[model samples]
Target: MCGIVGYIGKNEIKEILLNGLKELEYRGYDSAGIAVLQDRELSTFKAVGKIINLENKLKDFSTQGFGIGIGHTRWATHGKPTEANAHPHIAEFSNVVHNGIIENYQEIKEMLQAKGHHFLSQTDTEVIVHLFEENLKNCDDSFKAFKKTIDTIKGAYAILLISKKDSTKIFYAKNGSPLIIARGEGGIYFASSDAPLIGLAQEVVYLEDGDIGFMQEGDFDKLQNIQPLNINKSFAQKDGYRYFMEKEIYEQHSVLLETMMGRVSEDRIALENLDRDFFEGIESITICACGTSYHSAMVGKYLLERFAKIRVNVVIASEFRYADFVIKENELFITISQSGETADTLEALKLVKKHHLKTLAICNVDNSSIVRESDRVILTRVGIEKGVASTKAFASQVLVLWMLGVFIAQEKKLINAQEIKEQAQAMLKATKATKVDSKLHERIKRLSKRYLHGHGFFFIGRDVFFPLALEGALKLKEISYLHAEGYASGEMKHGPIALADSHLFTIALMPEHLLFEKIKSNIEELSARDATICVISSQECEVADDMIFIPKASSYMEEFFSMMVALQILALEIAIKLGNDVDMPRNLAKSVTVE
Candidate 1:
């Protein structure tokens, strides 16, 4: 979740590392620091807050030809966001910047303390440099010492290690978290998120679990233990966007293209998985996930049941392992996760696997542990989601699950190709039209003050909008700290109508469903009680005081674009109103790579 960047080559190390950190400020902004090696001496600059703080502190320093450096932006986990807990943690001789959690840091701290290694800060990352210092004292090679230290640590991490003795080399390792390295005009550069290095280099390398890279001068080598590693780069076109989330949302069309690549050639969309041996006599499918993945699972349940007439259940991963559910022998279990290393979802996978169930994984990362463990795996081509709040990755998961539904329905001969192709075309149209424009921003800005004054919020929708409404409310509450609730539009009269008043900000999701008019009535009732209304639908309806509209789509497809639009509005307005950092929310990291 924290940002980690490193630079090694014949250039001004401080300037490169500092600029990289500035570019990656979106990933984390609580605190920033950099450790640079100069003339065989280690110099460190640590700031208790944003990258600007570090930049101000280094205003007078020389950014000359230093070949190696590492920088960090921390999102505090083990301690408060203070100077003492800020990153670029240094021991007597070693400096390190680490992302991800160290589960057994306390244990290791005690071990190191017994050996007379005094501690300086309350950070899990600080234990690392001390451990590295201890290892270097024993081993001849620093990289070998790094490997030995990693063998003792538990939990997820993407680390960059530097030493006073080895001023030219920067060593990095990753497991479960994202870390990318790019070869640049100056030298080799590394960053936690790719946005920092977008224009700097077109060639990039992604570091996966169990892989390490040793960088120095103009050359570098990847390794697994002592052996060399071979890496591949997947090219992508970013077009033009300020943020990855924006680029990714716009890339929905490309994602749809990829999903439909081999599926709908003429009219036939085949369901290859169901026709395989795994589902020959399968009676049911159980889906599990967390956060955005859980919403995809909910949509999967509806898709499978409505289209395939199959029995399916959706369960939250945190709750799945604790509950005693009936599991049949031929039943298939599908796990959906963006990272494929979510601790709760991974635990759920392990529990289900122990029971000898047939498992399939729908994940974004290929060759991930979930994919390796499952009997079958489907990978989403969402690329890297640098934003903490998921947008494009969630859309990609929904698209994949929808294709799975169409495939299964066709495999059973339940739906004809014409029907599936119509759906596919609708998806393509929706992706192409899912745009947030100036009009939407104007409406959202006008409604923000009203929403902030409201006592609580009620978001209502029908069918797929139920999940969409919940996700919208989640986004508002997650960072904005609003007290919000989501319900089916029809269920509003059942109980939620009682809470309707001038103090309520009612958000209605009225996509092109048969229940659209019914939701309009619910909006009318809220208006009658003097509650403010913000409606997201295909067109401006009569009940909406403020309306945000997008291109028409099937009700199922509307959820993806509608929720995305809603989230963008909420994120922007809330950030401005609350005076909080919109790009990097407090205590929230881009990825949850640790338990």
Candidate 2:
């Protein structure tokens, strides 16, 4: 995956592109590069490393004025992160920047090479410029040339192309990767991630798969399958934060608010835009996802089964595609993905489609391909998450999933609207009480060495903590590289207790609810096993060993907010102590766009 930004505005093109790169650098730090059209040609600067490395090289270089430009921060899929693999991959006549993989690049590259198209970088993106060049020779216009090039592409790509002959204009296309265009005071702006232009533009028009966007000096429009698609100006708010990750974390509050925002005061809680009949007809839910999104699926399963009384199965997307499992038409298959283009999840979706099951996608980006492919879509309005390692997006997904369960319960006549509202309000209050300890760094530094006792972790909760446990274990493993495990509190004795010893670290998600004592006993049993107990519970549950208390709230929702703050603190602490890249962990990209 990569972060790409394009500009056709009144300001100096290089400055805007460079600044935007700095903002989007969290997506990928492997390398950075920019291309700007000037003096009848594309001028480029590229370097392998952080965006800062690219900036250093550009200190003496000059490419200026209101012209079309594109920038990229790459996470290598085609080639190693090196100068030779950097973006703004330029040919003699065209410059291209890409955000996703070109799966068949080798074959295409060999074909182009045989045709005497000389290559430069070791990137699949370089193949696109070659294809575009070949297409330009035959096409009558620029948009057609771009479309023809797109038609020839074999894999996912959201690309920006600037031609030397047409410096006044730029062409872009998207397929299985994100690309959004927005109007600015000067002109049009494009970004793979939304944060770069949050303050610059309030209105945005997202580019769908197979859609091409063209922007000239003062105007831009979109074309879907070579036909114009109406562009709408939908306002997106930043809500004020220096970093999008921080804003996203706090948006957990809004996610709770929106999920419980309006309607539903009767004995039955009302769910907007949800198909009650879909739930009624389904006997099972197979929730599938990858990475942080997978953790969300695990959490969703716990909520669905506990409250809605439905059988739920959680599967990793990559594994689900290969597993020999029968998918009945009556089963409801759910997929969770923050970026709807996650490679394995998309592949899994294709697998589920073959089964003729009722499908649903829970995602942050609306109208994403997965949402389009699914039978029903539940949009998590969690705004742009910029940091590579998800914080807010994951939290919001959990909150929405919880609401979904409550809605399903109500639809099934299991829970009341008053119950949903009370739980929702508790979640909001927890958000307010959820304090990011300013002294966390120092506290985490000291707590680092002490975590080794936890050879494995047991996360226990009753209603929602089942998935919360899985999520906690996932966080411990993702950055900390800890061999952590999560299971229901009652199920601990089944098989996991064999691992509980003095060296074991028990994480009890004991919210102040009906199952508090049950969770406390699980922690006590682990404690008796001589394990170190770390309780992530409500303020009411007074525990002695390493207790991180959360605010008291309704049982239905406290687990989510409590889980967020505790997990964040634990993740940062573990990463810092383990000397891991908390933001960009090894071999893990923010969005798994490539399968």
Candidate 3:
């Protein structure tokens, strides 16, 4: 998961490249660099951590040229986050910025070293520029040399190559990694994702695997009718909020509407991309995803099994990649990813595609890798989630999955019209119920500090709420850098309750409509041991040390939507109390585009 941005135009290159990289900073921020070609000379600047460091290095640097440049923000796959290992790796002939793994780099490095070539850094990416440099000796054209270098490499990569020999063009190639070319105001721009291209470019092309091409100085303006990227510049701003995470956390109300607009209604969930009979006779479903998406899949498993009356399996995409799945005769494969370019999930999608299974993707980005690879798709219109910790995307994913499950149940005649109508009304109510207001925010902010002193936090629930517990604990751990665990409330006495004490915080999700008493006794069990309990529920739990009561939801689905938003706010407040970067948490990128 690295950010790669390049430009070739008449505008000033540094600011354009830097701004594009800033949009893609959620992809990575371990280290960053840029290689800008000016007046027939290539200049390279490197920084050890964060794009800001690179920006500082280029503060006083001056340049005069046609504005051809390539920049990188690294998530460091092959080497440590060091200046020596940063991207825009330069050799004698060509400089390169690459994403994805070079699986056969050691062997290739040895081959190149034997030919009297020397290496500079402990990175697999260094091999690409050096290989291109070596290939230039055999080919008259730099683009041909770049192609030969790509042909020789055996791994995943979205590569941008430039050379001192040809400052008028920016050559690119993609294989098993994300790379898109956007025709914008000045010229053609390249970014690993749509985040950078949006607002900057109107038309864009998502380059496919095995695609190789170059944008020459005089050639990009001819074809002007390509599909325009759905650009919303507001997604990149925090408005008056302190951080994007906070803005997104409060955006759930409108986000629910955005996700349901045109696609979800009272009588139907319009996923017409899948054939009418697609869900017919589907004995089971396999949902593959990672991180927050994986947690959403867990919730989906509960919904799909409860509503659709089908066996549902939620597999972590990273593990699913290597596992030998038991694919059934009438099984459906669904994958979830906000970026749709998550490397493990995309690889898993490709892996299952080999078995000829019908695939559906629930994603936010329109043309992400997962969306392109799937047989059918559902777009979660939560807008661009700039926060690396993921606020609105998770809410939208879970909501979309719920709608899909209920729709399938109706389509299969598993639920009657009365039941379907009730489900739809409950969803409509959820859009209003799942709102977080100033009262709850203030309440959460007031108590957010009490949680910071805990040794660890336990987010406990039962049945479907078990996954919400996991997600709650994950959010706390991700943003606050605190130790937290999510466990079934029933399993407290099994062994974990021994760790419960005043120093321990338990954020119990005890919904009034769903197993409230069952989870209440579990909370009481933890209370007996003097665990600091922050109860988030619609019921008054006398055993809780603190409470953030939500509006009583009408149904199980509504309960989840409301409680889910509450948990997200709780985590955001807690992280803010600890003075953590709420938007970009440490060592965590927004999109896990690499394993």
Candidate 4:
């Protein structure tokens, strides 16, 4: 994910743009740049690191008076994180800063090149500004030219465009990615999220999908929906913790409470946001998601099939977009995203909507693109998730998905009122059981020291735990920069056991119930192959070199919740021991706006 900030006002554009970028640091970026229109002259400056580097480069430069400028913090989707690959790309008269990938940039670039357009940078974003300038020739007005460009492009984007020919206005368009325009005292502003717009404006308007408009002299035409900025700067702060990831991990208790507030009761799963008829005719469910959300979908597949007696399919969002679907008339399509702007997931939802399918969205942010485009939405109640490596969001999604399984079961008359009550009570108990006691945390920290030196890791499990194994391996690979793989325990004996050695660390998720003896046998087989084993279970393992104990969960659903906390804490401790930035790991963004 990248960040976009624009201003057209009386304040110093340099300071406004720089401070705006600083506020967006938590979103994660490698390169940053700005283009300011002063005295009808567009001056562009760029740097290859943090906002401080950009500030240093602009130390001697001056933006004279009431200037319109657009700034961007780039995460290097299409090219390396260099000055040439930064944003605020300029072409002749038009300048653009973009978030999200431009899938058709190569084709568009070749078309522009055939027309004698010379490009300077290796970025899909450069194509956008060039296309805008090229369209100006045929269109009668700037507005038409901007609209034409938006229509021509075919990818996710939140664009901020300005022209040397007209200093009076700043143009914008948002497709799948996030872009919010705030009306400030001096001028109008634009940003990817409310992070930069928090202090500048109390009320902001979120640019809807396919929105193309302009802001001129503190006013513009694109005010479709305005809402109060509910969160403050304090929400973005790390508080006392050294990193936002740790703070978010510790906040799981409250986040789960927020997630389960109105939806879960003693005997029912009522989604107030969705109508009762949403699942009336649905016989099957198709869930599409990416990364951590995709893991939740896998668990959901098991939950829905086992508890609800419904046919469920889990597909990766990227693959689902290209695959032909055999959509049943009674099928319900569900999309999951932490930040509802995940490009692959959002686009997959749009592609499914083309089939006239009934769609439901499970997302954290209210009114995100996925939430807006889908027929129904269930918010995960995970407020501003700032960490690039997801923690709380992943846990909340599984919790919500489990509850959805219960809801579908009730709808199908497969589960009785008493069973629903048991499920609800178990959910509450599972959430409480997820808390990491100080002693367990201390043991995890000590064990992480040895784990920090492993050549590689294998997280092995079975059935529902298979997805948790994948999530655990992903967490390790993401934050610790380790080469780890997750596998179904049974699959290892076929071929992967060949790689097992003394240096290979295996984290075995063995619950007390639900095929416990079978999974324990899988662990013993791995141990016999000389793989170091760390077993997370309620029972003592005879073959374990190390073990982390959890309460004896009553159901697989509860084990799913508690095991997530164990894996997350282990990953966090290992990353911290290695002196890595767990929140913003290398080459990773909070949200993947690019496919």
Candidate 5:
């Protein structure tokens, strides 16, 4: 994934483009570049590293009166991360910035080479501008040439093109990848997502697949070509936090409230898309997801099985669609995804639908493909999660799954109305009790320094916490770039224990539950093997080198929420201490739209 930003406005184009790139840095950070139109000439600047490198490089260029510009932060899918491969690939007539892969770029490159078009960089994006130049030669009109260029290419892409022949306008198009256009007071703005246009515009128009349009200076309002989008713009700001992830980590309390708002009461749970009669006849449940969403599905398996007395299986979406698995008539398939557009998960859903099996989706985006394909859907109201590493969406997914379990248990008569009411109240109390102390962050910061250079890390937990342990390991590995593994406490002795040594740091989730003593013994075994231990629990343990004590909640579910919040904070602090990019980890993109 790459980030794209374009501006056609009266304000300083360079500054606006740079700030927009900074807002979208979380989407990509491999390399950055910008192309500005001034004096009827297209000027391009590119750097091989982060956006800051491009900003420094721009200092030498004078772009004071440039009224139109386009910028990109690339993730380097087609070529290596180098200045020559950075975006804003320029041809004689046009400069282009693109996001997504060009599946037919090799063929197009060969065709262009036969036409005597020379290439300078090894990137599929470079083919786009040159193709546009070739099409313009055959067709005098710029719009017709743009259409011909896109028609010649085959792949998912969101592209922004600026031509030297038309310096006053910016042409853009999208196929599979996301692209948004917004009109602010001074000008028109384009980005890959809404993160860059948060404060810049209250309303925006989302370009659907295969949509193409252009924006001219001083023509901010005439966008009848594209439809306006209906988005909830309530929580777009950082709310005083330095990073969106940090703000989202602390917003878990509010996230829980919003997740449960009006949908759950003392005795009843309302899932808008679910049919209670259908749920009663369901025999088994299968969940498919990937990454953090997969971890949430693992926890969902525990909740659904333990509470509803149903057999549940959790599968990684990427593997599930390929595996030789039969979909029974009584089995219900569920997919969990934050974006709801995860390629593997959506493919899994399609396979389930092909078998005529009933499907449900637990997702964040309302109009994503998974939601559209599912027979039923439950939306996770965590708002727009801008950070690449998810925070609030995970909590919201867990809460929604927990509520679903409660609903199923009530339907099965395993839990009475009064018990359901008590559980709901307990969840509400736990949401109120969840807190992240400043001192805890400071303490974790200190502990992180000792393990910054460790060979690797191991995270262990039992029952529902086992999935959380996996999530914790994922967070640490994703942003901090540390090698980490998660295991069930009992499974540690099977194989992972062989890797235990003083160079290895282990984080244990030992909540004061039924499996607490068993996990304690497991932690002792790791400690005896000379591994440093960090425990997240309600009570302090003598075996742990450092203990992160969370507030005791009324029930195991509440405690699980609190523990997850603490682990999120711990991971964030560790990433900060390591000087790693917490918002945008290297080699990882915010969304996995392609397989």
Candidate 6:
């Protein structure tokens, strides 16, 4: 995944492009570059790492009178993260910045070479600009030539193109990847997501598959060039938080409310988008997802079986697509993704479609590929999750799964309306009660400092909390660059406990649930070996060398929400204490669009 931004405005082009790139840096940060049109020539500058490097490089260049530019921050796929492979690839006739993989680049490169076209870098993106240059030979219109270039390529892509001959306009298109165009006070802007458009654009247009459009310098009022989109201005501000992650963490309460808004009442749950008859004859369900979404599915398995009395299987999307797995009759396939364009999950969805099984999608983005392809869809109203490490999105996914369990329970007559309403109210209370104060963060920071130089880490939880343990470990390792492993509390003694000692730190999740004593015993075992134990629990206990206390939840569902928020805060504080980049981690991208 990479971040691409284009600006056509009256402001200083370099500053606008650089600021937009910085805002979109979470998508990718391996390399940064910008291409601007000035003096009827396309000038490019790129650096090997970070947007700051690109900014330093631009100090020697002149950007005066330049009002049109395209920028990119790259997460390398086809080539190494080198300056030569960075984006804003320029050719004789056009300059282009691309996101997504080019599956047929090799074949096209050979044909272009035969036609006497030479290549510079070992990037699939270079093939696109060169192809645009070749298409201009057969067509006079820049838009038609760009379309012709798109016709020859295959795979997911969102490309922004600017012709040297026509420096006043920027042409772009998207297929199977995200690309949004917005109209701002300054001018028209385009980016991979809405984060970069904040404070810059008042209205945004989300491009669908095969959608092609362009923006001229003063064409903010013209809606004839592209499909008009409804603007929701709520997402434009950070609401006074220092970082997006912190804002998102605190927004979980509202996220849960929005996810369940108008859909749950005193006695019933309403998934209005899903047909009433769709749940009929669904004997089993297979949920496929990646990363945070997969962890949510793991928790869903517990909820569905315990409350809904339905058998469930959770599979990693990448492995499920390649493995020789069987889909039995009357089985339902569901996929969960925040972006709804994750390559492995989307590929698995395509494969599931071939079997003619009923499919459902739990996605945050409306009209995403997964949402459009599924027979039934549940949209999580979490808004745009800008942080690379997901916080609010995961909480919303769990809330939706809880609603689904209650819905299925009501459908089977296993639970009454009063019981359902009580459950909903409990959840609402839990969301409001889960808060991370400055004092808690200070304590977590102290714990993080003490364990900062440890060799590795172990996160242990039992029952539904097991998936949370995995998710907690993932967050710590993702942002802090620490080596960590998560294991079921019971399974810790089987193998992982041997790795635990004074040199390794253990963070245990001890919720006040059915398995509380069992997990506490696991913590005790680790303590016996002189392991430093940091316990996240509803109450303080003797076994915990350090305790991070959460509000005692009334139900296991509430406990799940509270414990999740606690662990997220722990991870964030740990990363911040270590001086790591919490928003954009090394060697990772926000959306994994390429396999």
Q: Write the per-residue lDDT of candidate 1 for residues 75-150, one digit (tens) a residue.
A: 7788888877887988997899998888899999999999999987898988999998898888888889888888
Best candidate (score: TM-score): 3
Error of 6 at 471 (Å): 0.6
C-alpha lDDT of all candidate models, in order: 0.74, 0.73, 0.86, 0.87, 0.84, 0.84
Number of the top candidate by lDDT? 4
TM-score of 6: 0.92
Instruction: Give TM per candidate.
Output: 0.83, 0.83, 0.97, 0.94, 0.89, 0.92
- Name the TM-score of candidate 5: 0.89
Residue 513's C-alpha lDDT in candidate 4? 73
Worst 10 residues of 4 by lDDT: 218-227
In candidate 2, how many Å is residue 194 off? 2.4
Candidate 2 segments whose C-alpha is farther than 4 A from its true place: 135-145, 218-251, 263-266, 275-280, 350-357, 415-449, 452-463, 479-505, 511-531, 538-545, 551-560, 574-587
> Candidate 1: lDDT of 542?
80
Please say which candidate is ahead in TM-score: 2 or 5.
Answer: 5
lDDT of 1 at 478: 59
Instruction: Report how far off residue 69 is in candidate 6 (Å).
Output: 2.7
User: Residue-wise lDDT of candidate 5 within 218-320, one digit each (tens)?
Assistant: 5556764444445555566678887789988888788778888988888787777675786857899999999999999999999899888899999999999
Which pairs clash (backbone N, Cα, C closer than 3 Å) in model 3? Answer: none
Clash count in backbone of candidate 4: 0
By lDDT, highest first, what's the ranking?
4, 3, 6, 5, 1, 2
Against the true structure, candidate 4 reaches a TM-score of 0.94
Per-residue alpha-carbon lDDT of model 2 for 197-305, expressed as tens digits?
Answer: 7566655777777877577864644432222223222223345653344445445554546554553343445555676877778788889999888877777877788
Give candidate 1's error at residue 355 in angstroms: 5.8
Alpha-carbon RMSD, each predicted model: 4.3, 4.5, 1.5, 2.2, 3.2, 2.8
Q: Give candidate 3 misplaced runs (Cα > 4 Å).
A: 221-225
**Tens-digit per-residue lDDT, 1-595, candidate 4:** 7999999888889988998988877778899999999878888999998788889999988765688999999998788899988988999977899998888899999999999999988889899999988999887699899898999999788999999877778998888789988876767888888788877877788888788888888464437667777765775778897788888877887888889998899979987666557778788999999999999999889988988888999999999888876778888999999888888898888887888889999999886788889888888887788888888899889888888888878877888999999999989987887676778778888889989886899999999899999999999999999989999999988998999999999999998777899998888888998899999988899999998888787887677777888899899999999999888788888878888
